[model samples]
Target: MENRGAKPENVEIGLGKESFGVTNLQDHNIHTEPELGLDIMRHSAAHLLAAAVLELWPDAKFGIGPTIRDGFYYDFDLSFSLTPDLLEQIEKKMKELQKQRLPYEQSEVPIDEAIALMEEAGQSYKTELLHDLKTKGTTAVVKGLDDPNVFKTGMETVTLYRLGNFVDLCRGPHMEHSAQTGFFKLTSVSGAYWRGDEKNKQLQRIYGTSFETKADLKEYLARKEEAKKRDHRCLGEELKIFTFSEEIGAGLPLWLPNGTIIRHELEKLAMEEERKDGYQRVATPHLTKADLYYRSGHLPYYREDMYEPINIEGQEYFLKPMNCPHHHHIYSAEPRSYRDLPVRLAEYGTVYRFEQSGSLNGILRTRGFVQNDAHIYCTEDQAKDEFLRVMQLHERFYRLFGIKNFYMRLSLPDMDRLNKFVDDSESWTKALKIIKAAMEESGLPYVEAAGEAAFYGPKVDFQIESVMGTEYTMSTNQLDFLAAKRFNLEYVGSDGQKHPVYVIHRAPLGSHERFIAFLLEHYAGKMPVWLAPEQVSIIPIAERNYEYAKKIHDLLFSADVPTAFGGVRVQVNHSNESMQKRIRAATMKKIPYMLVVGDREQESGSVSVRTRSGVDLKSMPVEAFLERITKELKTRQDLPVE
Candidate 1:
């Protein structure tokens, strides 16, 4: 049984009123039927997990166990610490419980009676939560709230899921029995604070995912294995692309020589592309006055992610966490005419944000990173076309990199939750319509996310699910009329009247680091010819043929094909090692091509080509081989046969 919320409607009026809030509360009724098959199975599996845990650890106190995207996690307060071995044991016990085919019995209980039962069972955590709920008067709030009400005033009766002697406080629509949860795996264990508040006591979080079939579980595990092989951190280390140093801080990555080559290449491509698209590049300081962020409203909503301010001459300055505020200042830098109305400012700017230590996973999520950021200042009439152009750019970049599985997300404000949205509903509605029209005209698949829009305006977020079943927002194209107004950015219209220019904030490739990481996994580290660090490696048969191999390396390197020389001495010991061993070493590096030079080839003024797949081409003229490689590099070919 899937627990779903009400689908939001396209309300006719603008979302401008302060009283306007999120719609579709009726859709998420607990009594409603489930829409997603996997959701119900996963929720039921959580109950099985609780049952297994209770059988093993009789005193284990349970916290919230809910189904999340791709998985479910249950928090437990235990006398003994849980470990990976214990997770395996729990999985074993869960399988046993599944064999029993126990039924899930859901029961509704009053707040007072539930507290007494939990207290009798020595569930201190649940009892404490019950007391806190009563102290905060949540029961009265839930009881008083109506279906259309966005916020509840008092708590209502709570539901509990009972499996034999084990019971958990949950609002669940679980499957009928544990046997219905066909395939499951316990993935990881971590620490999580109660209620997501850092001040609260941390609880042990066990994360596991469930599926409807063993085949589905196998496929999921296979994808995870593929993801592991393609992990950017592992690839980066093996390729000597980048590294992190203790001295350089936790979130900062130090790019090595080969890694810098790829980084600079990507930046060069972005600079030329954006320049051709009529963007004027500009550089900004890494740190700026705190007032700048305050004016941009980032201080009000996102200050927690920002670093502590530095006091410079009694004035506070902060390392910028975003490039928009600085670019806004650039827009306000000088007086502008109507002809300069569509001013596009672009930057490969690096910004800093304080990500939680647990959240940081290599360069994918870093504290300091560069963004392929650009802001287009245009008239309101041009907003639609401008947004479409940004979307086009995103498509062009992704297409060039062969990224096909992605969708656009139209994020709009939830007017019902007025506190979560920016003040003006009319502007949001207008911007939403413009973005929606642009997306529709472009023939792109998109879904609207209520309450997910930026504070200043609505946005279209490009989303992709990774091999690990984790979803990531890859790129964004946002429409911002409010930021223009807030920054007082204006241009004289044809009628000689000052009008605020609309802003289209777009980033196609996102950040170089993140894009490369995704590409690394997408291609499984076998990068396309043009992007590979070492496209070709020339291997000499013996020490005697080193000179000829050097000549070939120089020829390939001069042609701008990234090539390296591997001497026989590096791998050969006397006559014991086979040529196949040396070739396998080169193949392990995922080098696209390997040219094996020997006395026969040197005498013929030609080279023997061994593609990464071990296909050998007889001695060919130097110019002929060079042309083939040059063509492959230019076309960004990945296939060895090509």
Candidate 2:
């Protein structure tokens, strides 16, 4: 598929396939080259994975296998739980099949024949898939919107791929032979619901990665190992940043004291920045009447993510999943004129979403979290400037956090699937044009994505790469043209007529929980001096130096660093453990600086400074040490870890 050792030819990489009585392939193919991409190789790798699984467990009924970002996975209803040892055995089997040079051949037949083939193989999932394809078109059936009663006749031919004795229902342009599947390795396995429905049976999903070359695979594995070490769930506990409790239920994080400090620091920074940007702070209730959500159209569009409603005094109330609708009410509470355009409302509001437990990953995703949210209500003429300002605000925060590798994703609607988005083509067009103009004016790197916009409008989502090269979606700034009409939001223009205003929804800092999670993994627990919960640890060498340590700690605890909201955080370690052990404990907590106070330091009024990275700054006066750390905190600089 990668064409590593083969010449190019017209391979139908873009043309439609003759399958399921479907005439003419769809034009959604974005690529038209014979040089198939790595995704093609990865897709074949999934088939190989399924083939190996079937070899080990003959009765294993497999589900669909798809290519993810850098890898592939196949779901199987196995008779036994999969383990790391089993993964090795399956991998060995895949290599054996590869050596056999089994050719991948495609076959086309009627739907009933395909169904019979799956029935003989005892693949209920594949049989069910065939039934759906027979009744619904390719798109609706794949998305699980099939209606068995509404079957379409006269077009029942389907396609399948065969590898030796293993035949699978697939629309594939796989490698010519199994040997073409280059370097691959099974990474891990997890439980996934059949078709991602929690009500359905849970199946074993095996994950793996493949590359065109061994070196590429090796490099990817190394990066993956680095990510494993920096995983927020593990690092959060090891560093005592945060933890989850069984008593508190799943998908909820209990922020420890150190984690609280990080959240507070982030909140203070956001508040200061928003204040300078002319944003007025506001607060709203956590839950409101269900009628409000119905009015906002969230009930129809986002009901799945919301928790069940609470019946209060014969009325139903729901937890707020977002702050947009509430802020709209705030805007409508009072009359406004042309002079009052661009109403900037900011809040650190806590919102709730019923995220599936299996998808939860520590604080990166949770049930309840506070969002650093804001909405700008401005006139049509000021919408462009307001959007540009929001982009600039995001850049400022990114620069402050040393997030250098990021790009904006322009998300727009798909006209083909208008059911998912607002049925207002005029608004969609205007919103897309305005956001694109703002992005172009800013000269920031960005890429376009289709069918990923909010239900009501287009948006720009920020995708950031951590220092470890792991990328994630960070935050978004959306332009809404429908909400004003939905909420009857209006302002008096200079002509004294009521005119609708545009709304710009933005959450530059996203949520405190997720942002702190990103910051934790991004820094590898070595937070900047300004954000470190315990900035300096005073480790006295002996009992006599305890008093001196306390004095130095009190000095730092009281001194306020410039540009920092609070005083420097310093703790004196008067533990009975050995001096080196105390220093090591402090380092393990990721304290930026450890000040060793002893006989020489007590007499000279100086401290022996050691960094968490084990750098010995030698002996310096206590005042000098204070000045150095103060500068670091004032500048919000990262202490050298290497």
Candidate 3:
């Protein structure tokens, strides 16, 4: 250990530093590579930020600062509030320190001594963490929401990284010096609860991002600005699609009339597709007896996400978190044979969950949402084919929506975390093999992750990126070997013996709420002709054109002959507002078409069409316009009206 000057008790003024030599760096592989080093640099930037904050406000206390998806955030329990001005000041201080090229000196101290050092410095949170590490091991500290990799179990000493005058408890693979953190910009600040619990103190979190090059940082900032403009919460309100009320509660979205229309179009498409795929739609009650969940193993494994049970008629009922249990009961209601195997049960089921308020984001993460869910109970022999069929169905839908940048993530269980999954190792192995075979047979790109599987089995989550490059899990498909045994779902085999059926749970569209949110951002609220709530809006140039506009509206409305895409919703704007104002209103609503009727148009029996994209499809006969739009609707293509 190199003693820079400070004593061991305080570990300040850069003293008693442990050696992180070339051998240790090689063994641990501290990130010094290209793109792989971005996270390490960002994490080091977080420490630099903390050191700057302490320089400005010596009394400030900080919690853990971790690297999130594209950035890093540090939480501070400060006596004063942080603002944009303060962020700039902190950035200036960080630059001053960076110019010095201060080395990230390392030190290791006994757990008790570390606690004493934190206590002397008045960092109660750090003290608490050190005590937790000493008493319950690193696993227990991880359960308290700290990073699991930050400490090792049964270790008597903890590593601390010192950046100048500031010291932090961390098991680090950070950049060598402050200058190596690359170009960074402080983005924003928000309030966050310590350990993600609402009961804990609310700490002000400062968010920022780092990039390897100035051009990369500039490009990221540009994309971030575009993302802000395309934020779903803002667009949802501007489009009048959805709203939330305090009385209705958080994460429970209230869809407006226009939003309902959009949902109807999506549901119509789903029904048509499922019908062609030979799926039998089933409906189940929103509430079910708690015993059913226990039998399905959801009560024990997913209790935290589920709502509390409701007692009625001396029986406990739970708002169903999923429809699999109900569908199982339906399958067992009638006896089945091998010939009757491979029952595909589909449902647009509305399920309820008690999502944490902090995690809720617009309609994306909601308490009440309807899933485009289905279950295929098939024999082992037919399992691969059925799974491939589901994958094909997903591909078909994605192709229709022009969603090309999506991939599957195979989530497998970690034996170390066996408590989170079922104890049936044999079943787990078989299910994993089946899913792997089906995925490989599809010849699609996929990545595997450990400890992310479902409680009963392994699953493939379809991760999709929006136009702004933000990725999320849009759909999921799981192969379950335990559900059959748990629910006693069986089919008689060719040998006249009852055999447990293999179950595949899939949700291609995920939920209307989340999918709609994605669509709002993906399309920038300019929905395609087929999915637009008001497909056409007729605006009269003057009062004389009113009659002609009404005639055009009626014609288009009636021409919406019952099809799977449903009716082409058309409206006639007869309000006293100016024609341009009406046109602007329709444009703001993202209506696919604006048909302008004037004396010349009326006399010629034509309508002047203007698209939401500012394309003027000059005068055309009403019949010709309808024919063109009808074809677009039928095809369900995002053919922007030109």
Candidate 4:
């Protein structure tokens, strides 16, 4: 750890669930290798930031300062408004503190003393936190606090971290002194509700990131700049993929023709794959009786995410938050026998959730989204096989999307919270064993996470890393022994007895909205031929070539190319624009291929083609070019360029 330079933000101590504790780096064997090391430095930098902010504003009320994928943010309620100038000033203060070599001294003080000190410092938030700690009986293992996950351990303690004159109530595994945090910059600031509740006062959140070396920070910023250029929200507008309107309502995306075409293609691909896997297509109503959710045990556990019930006549109903409950009802709708034991049902179900407004991020986090959801009801003996099949489906989707960096996060139930989890000891043990065995056999890299599982069963969440190394938890599958038991879904086994069936819930693509966003960033909006809204844009070099361009467009429209909006997306630039300008416009739209027609090409019965990357393919006969692209589009080839 010293070789990596200085102390880690926190140490992983033993907890019934996932937890970390603050301690000197020398106390335990800490591995700050690469990614983990970067995270530690960034989190530690957050402490440095709070310290800096404290110097600027003596009345600043501190909030959580957790590290995100690429940066960290700390919320502070201050007397004066924050500005770009203020951020630069804070950075200077941080640098001064860094030079002072203030050790991140961790101490455990009596709850009374801690509260008094916080009150004296005029930090109501810290005082309130201390009061909560007192009520919760601050009995942590009494060590350094570092990781943000440490807070969730539910331990009440006053771990005071003092650096120079600025002190904060935190879990310290910060740096031995401030300088070890390395190079850091204050990126930006935004209004964040204290504790993330809208009703709470809005606190200004200062965001920043840190790296061990200036070069590393430069490289990270370059990738970040690249990511901004490929951001789906921007590309979506430029390519006319999707749009939003205040009149249409928030988070409800209005898909244009191009976006609709791409969506249908993705849906077509998933449908065909599931069909080959013997999944029967099924559809459920957008709304369902509230009793159905109660029966499936979603009413209490999932109530917060779900919208308040709609009063349909005298009974209350709900827009479905998930498709599994409806599928469970479907399973119980008919009498099942052993021969029909392993029934696979699939749907491209659209579900709704009352997501917090601040948490929404383009299509990635939306109020309404479509899920590639499916459920399988099978005997206990068949559970592993079905789960493995689901994993394979997930792998296939990742391959199709050209996502190579990914692993499974096996979310296991927290044993201590039996009430939150199903209280079936035998079932829990058997289900977990089955999931683990299947994962081990799959030969995929995976890690187990305690307390991340659905209340019903353990889940396998697929975490995908984009080309830029940003990770997203985009897909998942979970075994459901509890839902089956709750819904009383059973099958007539060969033993001539009605036995409760095991259920497997799987979503390979997650949601079209979110998946498309991932694809946009993954491909940088240059989707492959199959997924591109406009597969080809036909451009006429002059007015003489218009007739030939239309003919080529007709040929494509007649072929297997997708049709949306009106007819096929065989865009013909009929406007009197320069050839270069037209070509550039087509390239900007990210059309997979552009067909350039001129007098010579028309006379030769050929078309010159250029890929979205502007590489010329010279001239080829119209038939030959059609054959090449149609085959590529139909097969959904993972192309080298877009």
Candidate 5:
């Protein structure tokens, strides 16, 4: 062991103690422990990936390689295209070097020296980045400063990592040695722009994942396979529920007839529940003047998430990205008395948010979505009660969907990081206290997170992890005292004086697009009977039983069960296909039940009931089958079928 040159005196290891205001790193307990420390190892593995690429292809140029949530990726510019077979070659070289356990050595170089080295290597992208840093006010790296031997007019000292003669400029807290990166696999290769700017040249990006043990890697791969089977995009297409077209643009889903049926059912359920909860249904325009956003502070802070304003007769208008401001205007439409202190306004509002193209994944992340949105206008004394009611509503709905593995997230602001939160500190504190109290009274398990609150208030977000081990925000209940003040919303108090009102913004179902997509995966496309697009299917054993099948279809259709008849193509089982083939077709469509009719069943005045799980209920009265389905539909039960 050579000891790696006395550990390089100016290592600069560990998070900045002063910036985080922590005198002792151990006290905060925020050090990169085993899991995150292993991530650093994987990041070093990414560098190894790039090093192998450069060794194999001498002219290859580097872009960036960073560890993501569960994996790492590196972008490269190569003379030849990369394929799966090529990735194996790269992996072979990486393992060869890993076996050597090469030391990752760091070195500081002068500005001109670094530039000349990269230029000779034809790394023009790095040169351009260096020049951009110089244009900014960075004076740490200079052209020719001799005494301190440091770059005085560019990015602070450029750090380079060298492993067995392969060098890369990086800001590293890498693994101590290459051998630490274990149980790694190269997953895929795709094209990406340099630094995510579309105008930049496209580079080939290689994605890989690493774990501390082989078992972890195997578990990750198994979860990935499970997620693939549950992907809503594939399920939606197979079930003929939704489709996307290039002509309709990306992120806009075109719902087929079956999909629309599901959407309408969800809307109906929400509307009924909200009406019972004393909510007043209202509708708002999809677009509003830009001045409206200015009044709500959205124009200045949230404009990036909104589409660019449209100019009309010297006035700017924008498609609404949220429904709160519009609902605020509706609340202010007339003078309010103390009796109307807790007015609940609800809407299935459609909104448009500008999501990055790379972020869009079917309906889960879309440009346009409809939120099951509502806002409660209440007095300060009613804030806690209102929040509690919202939480109860959320729990009730989750129970309906059999979602039990979720918890509350109390999102509060970082008082020390003022820029990360709204300027009104007192209001934020009050809102945070009220939400915390509500969560406690509701008796729900919750975890607090700093810097996760909304700009207008503190919030309690409901989070659920998907089958793929990815966390998603299911719904949110936010308390706001600032929005009321900003919009000048006030009501007469008991003393007959006008006082600012409090607001609670809630979305129990979040966005319809995202929730449906989650349910599609969570249930593996086997939707609950009530939510199933095609609840029942009618099949005739032969063409001779066609009349009986049509009668059964009409009867079920009249009973409000979604049923359709399978025609001659599905009826004729004489060809290569068997009865199992027909049943498999219905199962693949996720039809909750199938009614198989033949002369025997027709003469007996009963139907052969077959459930989605391949259970053959020999012969049951049509009335009995309808009764069971009706009960399940009305109660919205997650029934265990035979």
Candidate 6:
């Protein structure tokens, strides 16, 4: 048992290391304390749920029950489809079990005895799990690892959690007893394939939320409701930002005109920032030879996520999955001295990955997207300064976007998994020191995650909070000391000898698709004026003033206030609809400016300017209106909105 509060103390009980048991709980130390001991409470509630399900369906084979952000879920193999009424019954049963004050008893059972107990209880899944563990060293060639609970590791003993009449295969540091699980709700039930493989049998997955107190749960539920209202998928379509087509493909989005405008503006802004920081822009092909990836050491580590190779001219080519390899080739394509030591290359490069269909979420997760990718090559001494600069750049980005809630995560390597990476002890130590010094120098609040680093290097992942209070990774900065040697890229040092350059890989905006999706939800479709699809919507009071509206549109369009989609995002609503209706339409579209031209204003060579927030700025001269908009666009200021 652990302390029951937010940010728990020593909740994780590690069995051992250097040949650790491969259960999900084994790694829970990294994620043990989450928001007021909620993880422990939710985790305990999962056991309560399992106990409840087993009571109703005696033969139900239970699967893993992991605690999620707001709640937890447990998969069960049952005889019938689940319904809401049955969920209520399960919740009711769980409440009854809680009244019994059951204690979760952890026991170490011998492997053979564990298998015999599961087999006798008709838990075929558990038996298969142990059987796989016993044959883990035999290379039995599993058709597919289709069970999330199945860890094919031959542990000396199986740790089981017993709660009343129900026994589950679990590595538990659960609550002391059932009272800790009092405030919980069984949220929903859905069918999920075992282990997320479509070919595997579908199991009923029950989802629920648990908090230490009812007030906390209520606040969380309210946030959940708000999240639904601000979901990017809904906001995107309603605001004409982006849409999907089944005929086009899954995990691939065809950016709508409005969405294209936002992306173009973002690219333009990022380019300007990078240019100011001495970054040279370059473009690379969408496809490259597979040999390049093999040389870059990406094939062995990332081949599963990469698209299959394309056969061209009897050579295997692949869709470029990452930009670093190509950038490294660029660095090696020329000869240089220490003067070019701090070479920075940037691009809005498009990359492809074969994301599983189920894992894809609108624009947030897609197969094809463009990244604000950059690579910096500098001397070993300049590496820390460059890393600090990257961190400063990240802070600049967040400030510009009004993102106040975020922290950096320093991802370090796991010594136990050294074989999976390029294991140069000296290089790893040097790189870790450089990054750690930079982090300390930068004086930024950060957290550390072990075993989260890339195969090539450690990295800093920028986790930004969405408007809904959800923290998500918005950017990543990595320190790579091996890519230079791997690509044979070298620059002559001041000592007049060839030296391996330090590589710093960064993506401040992450990707065009995901960032735009985030902005949509973050601003609630009230995009900043510079990045809004349509900066101004011209609405005439009646048909008689349509000509004046057209003239105003022409003038603004002619000014061409730096918009995406290759043109000014100005529209003249010449329809016969009432001016109020047209204004309403423009407001709903999240247009930053609505210029309503009527007879008197048209004759006065002026127009009534109304902001998207419904503030009427009365009538102003056409020149002054244009200047106001031009200044807003130039400064890229976020205007106040409704």
Over 1-642, each residue of candidate 2 has an lDDT whose tens digit, in order, gives 110101100000111111101111111222223235688888888888888878878999988898876688999998899989999999999999988888889999998999898998899999988887777634232433355533355348888999867888888889888888889999999999898888999999999989999999999899888778887888899888888999999988998988888888888788888998889999999989999888876675557668999999999999988888899999999999989888999999888887788767788778888888898999988999899989998899899889998888776556665443335777678878888999999888998876544445666777666787656566767787877888899999999999998988888787887788788878988888888888889999999888998899888888877534466788898889998999899999899899999999999999999998899989999889888878887667764543
Clashing pairs in 3: none
Which candidate, 4 or 6, has the higher lDDT?
Answer: 6
lDDT of 4 by residue, 1-642 (tens): 111111111111111222111112222221223477777778778989998988887767887788876678899998888999999999999999899888888898876888889899888877877776676443233442553444534344467888777787776566688888899989899999766568989999999989888998898788878988988899888888889999988888999987888888888888889998999999999999988777765565557667988998999999988888788778889999989969999999988887787667778777889988888999999999888888888888888777898788786666776454345757877888999988988888898776555445666767777786666667767787876667789999899899999988888887888888878888999888778787788989989888999999898787765333333457788788888988888888888788999998999999998987888988999988887876676667844542
RMSD of each: 7.0, 8.4, 10.0, 8.0, 8.9, 7.2
**For candidate 1, what is the TM-score?**
0.76
lDDT per model vs. reference: 0.73, 0.79, 0.80, 0.77, 0.74, 0.79
Identify the runs in model 2 with alpha carbons over 4 angstroms from their true place. Answer: 1-69, 72-173, 189-207, 413-433, 450-457, 493-498, 562-565, 639-642
What ranking of all candidate models by lDDT puts the best one first? 3, 2, 6, 4, 5, 1
List runs of model 1 lying over 4 Å from the truth.
1-40, 46-68, 71-97, 104-176, 185-208, 415-433, 465-470, 492-499, 560-579, 613-619, 637-642
Winner by lDDT between candidate 4 and candidate 1? 4
Mind giving the per-residue lDDT tens digits that candidate 5 earns over 1-642? 000011011111111222122111211211113367867988999988887887788888888788976789998988779988999999998898888888899888865677777788888877765555545423233443453533344454476788775677776889877888888889899999886778889999999989889998998888878888988889889877788999998999998987877777788778878888889999999989998887776676567667988888999999988898889999999999889878999998998877788767888778888889999999988889989989988888888887776678775555776444345777778878888889999997788776544456666667765545445566767787877777889998889999999988888888788888878887888887787887777777777777887777766666764223211111222333455677787898888787787899889878888888787777898888878787776677845765
CA lDDT, candidate 1, residue 446:
80
Candidate 6, residue 592: how far the Cα is off, in Å: 2.1
The segments of candidate 3 whose C-alpha lies over 4 angstroms from its true place after superposition are 1-36, 47-68, 73-97, 100-174, 191-205, 412-433, 450-457, 492-497, 561-566, 640-642
**What's the TM-score of every candidate structure?**
0.76, 0.79, 0.80, 0.77, 0.80, 0.77
